[model samples]
Target: MSTFLLEIGTEELPADFARLALPQLEQLVRRDLTEQRLSHGVVTTTSTPRRIALLVEGLPAAAADLEEERKGPPAGQAFKDGVPTPAAIGFAKRCGIAPEALELRDTPKGPFVFARVLERGRPTAAVLAEHIPQWIGALQGRRFMRWGEGESRFSRPVRWLVALLDATVISVTLQGSDPEVRAGNTSRGHRLLAESVTIPSAGAYAESLAAVGVQVDRAGRAAAIRSAVLEAAAALGARPDLPDDLFDELTDLVEAPLLIEGSVAEQSLGLPPEVLSTVMRAHQRYVPLYRSGAASDPLALDAKDALLPRFLCIGNGLPAASDTVRRGNERVLKARLADAEFFVQADRAVPSIDRRDQLARVTFAEGLGSLLDRVERIEWLTDVLLEQLQLGAATGDHARRAAHLCKHDLVSQMVGEFPELQGIIGGKYLLAEGEPRAVALAVLEHYLPRGAGDDLPSSDAGAVVALAERLELLLSIYAKGERPSGSSDPYALRRAGNGLLQILWERGWSLDLQALLRRATAHWSQLLPHFSVQAPALATELAEFLRQRLVSLLEEQGVDGDLVQAVAGEGVAIERVLSDPADARQRADLLAALRASGELAGVQAVVTRAARLAEKGSLDAARLSPAGVVDAALFEKPSEAAMLQVLEQLQPIAAGEGAARYGELARALAASRDTLAAFFDGDQSVMVMADEPAVRTNRLNLLGVLRNQASVLADFSRIAG
Candidate 1:
């Protein structure tokens, strides 16, 4: 067993880039090792602002030998009457084996000649030396750079390489315009705290680096940071606002973290808590502090008192000089907060109404009209959805108002400088203007769930407006041939689609998606006749797109693939899918449970037998019987009469709303399975396609009637066993 280490030293990397790319680097090394037939165990990666290190343990010195089959020409061509021909001889020579060493093997293409070859695996050190450079080059992230005009792109400039197999160094040339740096045992420590240090062996890598103030282990660094913050906050009788994402980023930003307390300006406290936190955490990478004199949860900041005007930051060096770094950061943050205040004050100089007109100058897309034009589309679409949901005028008024107000902040100064604060800033501005609280909050809630796992809109009006806006965006962009394809979703239409479906699922409103899409297309056609030139063609495309997104969402929720397919099968209305995703899911769950419980075997048999006959037997009669009518007078079997009576009873119940109703319909269908079986299985069984013309037509009409009635609920034929 051997301990392998790879250290890529580079210039300071962004915390996010290092944190995201380090895991991929570790995986790439593991994959390369596995592909070379090298077995390893406990591969782990750690990173700081300056370097990423992959330390693997329990790795064998060499890969195990492999036996492989090398197939050659067919038997007919390889030999002539049991004698080796030139073809066979040449193939055996190429395989580095004598002709007799080859064996006859039977293949799909008839008899073929095969050769058995033993391949001795190379040493692990030799393989790592060859692939180390390739693995490093393969590391990528959202932002990568090629320093010194070289094609060797990385998160930052590569300054040193440390690749070792056991006690010996494995050399590799980065093979680009990069300086000819060779892998060695030498490794550097904290850029500010410690100088260069030499790692004697792979086992001593962590201990030697720790001597120089570099905490190479990510878990150790995070723990140190947390302990420092908690101890510091304890002195002030407050809790540190240390969320996981911020904590990770802070830990990655420094090799030697030292916690320091800084003061938030008194004037900045007058600003909104969002603004305060944004300035402290987002702009300065500092954690906010809260005041707590009582015995509240030490880890929690929420209490009856206001948040204290203080913040804590993790410095990259020893605490002795951290005061200077803290003051510098505080000065920089004060300037940013001052700028935010200025932008907010300037935005208020002009009334929100006046700012809305400026949106006409801001283009939504190249061909699509300005932002104001989109507002009109969203307003119209939102009102239509409200009406579809059967909501009264009061809700419609709130949704429309929210739609109009939502994008107004896009043109505001505060949001222009801080794009992430778009919706929240708009809500704050509306509240300050004395708008209704519902209208104000709806402006914010429409952008709820900005990402996966985020909250859905809390209010019904907000959900409606959110759906309308996303639907309009999808239809308008897809109309312009800008549909998301092959992951090139420039318009983020997929996220828009996701948000729309999420709102529907959360609100549980059964708005007709197919109808809404068609309506949106129509609205675009009238509003932008030139832009929506092919508006009529977009409805079906957009519906299928939304269906795929919904499928992805449902599958991601751990629903059975076959059950999801079954519930979303033929005649599964798109309106029901988008309006009541939960109900559709419930139907799938109910059917899946019944199928697994063996409660629907008889029902399945009846549906399979009847639907199969319904297709071939009832063709001409079904074409004539659009209403699927069967004359009672023509019924010869009592079983047929009894089934028709039961079908009539199940009609209104199956057609009723809710998943419970669908479950009841399934039970009723299962209950009638015996009578349906008797109709087809017994001695008095009537031929659906009888020789008598009237009997054939009447029986075919009867099967068609049953099928047509079942069509209202689901296409049982598409259901999977």
Candidate 2:
């Protein structure tokens, strides 16, 4: 066994590309090795800004030999009375075996001639050489470009390549380049430190790079950066706000980590902490420090008590030039902060209401009216939701006010410069202008949960406005006749649908979503008659979209897929799902709990059996009672009457709504397992397919009623036993 190493050195690559390419490279190497019959152990990949490296340990010098069975023509054609024929000789020659070596083998399609062929293994170096070029060409990333006269595309220009089997250099060459790159045993070091570094062996790659001031191990570099930031923050009595995304980018931005502490301008501290932090983190890639015990919730911390006038940044320059780097970064940050301060000052000169009027100049979408028009629609939807929810007048007023002012900041100078601060700046401006705190917070949180695993609105007013905002986007965009097909959701309609369901599920609100969509679509049809929007069809489309989103959200919350299907699958009516998303979520949860408690199998068995038989009878799925459909007079067995008794007991529970009733329905089904079994089998059981047509219909109706009652909880046929 020997170690193998391959390093592709390039000009500084994009941080995101470098982070994403490591896994791709590792997977490619593993797949190629397996395909070549080369067994390897512990393949690993790492990357820095300048290079991506792969190392494999415990690799064989050559791939294992393969034995294959080659089949030829039928036995009768290959041989004549145990004498070699021309066909048998030709087949043996093709398989590189003598005619005597071929043996008769019996197959399903009659006997055939077979030969056992052993193929020679290729050298590991040769295999690596064959696959190395393909691997480099297979890598993918955004904005890939070709340098100079080269036709090959990469995230950046390829400058050097390194490939070694133990201490021997593997012969490989990369084509399609103005300056063709070839594999060697030497790799470049840090840009600011040592130049070229020689790898004496594959096992010494990391040590060799480290000696030249390059930390080739990405995890090690990340650990060093994290420790430095935490220690610096601890010494200064502060906490570092190092988001995972920022931390990962920092790790990939350097070959050697050097932490530099810089001071924020005292004047910049007067701005909102979010403004300062966003500027440092998003714009400059610096980690902001917050004062200790600033606030219990870091997200809600105020400017005065939270932000410290200091930040820490990671650099790849020489340690002796730390002060120079610090001063340069501080100067750049100061200039950006000054620009932000100017924008804020100008924005404050105009009242938020004036900004609201400016929205008329901005189009939300083609044929969808202006931003102000959308705001009006949102306000109207807010009122509708408030009435449906029966929220108090105070909350309704706050939500309406927030909805009106939500888009005002889109035209503000501050938001124009920092597009991410749209809602944050608007809320601060509103609070400064003496608006109610509830209204301010609602405006800020209306865009909560920007994506998956993000925060949701915590306040009632915020929740209500958020729902209205997302609902309007979904309705208007969908009515425009563009749907999110495949991977293309240009208007983020899917996100809006997901957000709507997420808010409803989180708040435990029971508003009928189907009714809301109908009313909103009708209002849109009236507001923009030229668009030719069909109210009912559009409402139905939006409801189905939300139903899909609800199923996805339920499964994401750890509910089993089958359980999710049982509650909200295609078989379940879309009206029931959109009537109350929270109810569907609870049903899924109840089913999952039943499965975990070992009671679901019994209920599923009984319900599924009845549901299958119920299809033979013309009974409505919504019918829960057997009062008129099931004829007790047609019964000939005691089991039939016992099954009818269980259905009667389940009628009221199945007819009800909410989690408690669903639980009761599940328990009733579980208890009826034995009774249902007796009706289907054993003594006192009536044949469901009796010769008497009336008796058969009556028996099927009894099963159909039971099936209908279970349908109230789920479409049991869709559930997996």
In lDDT terms, which candidate is top?
A: 2
Kindly report which residue stretches of model 2 are placed more than 4 angstroms away from their true locations once superposed: 73-116, 296-302, 528-531, 630-641, 672-678, 681-684, 688-697
The sequence of per-residue lDDT tens digits that candidate 1 reaches over residues 461-576 is 88888887888788788877776779698888889988888787777677678777776787677776776455557787887788888777777877667667666743466655
Location of the lowest summed lDDT over 10 successive residues in candidate 2: 295-304
Quantify all predictions' global Cα lDDT against the true fold: 0.78, 0.90
lDDT of 2 at 701: 91
Judging by TM-score against the true structure, name the best candidate.
Answer: 2
Off by over 4 Å in 1: 67-93, 96-118, 149-151, 223-244, 289-306, 570-586, 589-602, 619-628, 631-638, 657-660, 680-700
How well is each residue in 114-160 modelled by candidate 2, as lDDT tens digits? Answer: 99998889999899999999999999899999998979889999989
What local lDDT does model 1 show for residue 57? 92
TM-score of each: 0.86, 0.93
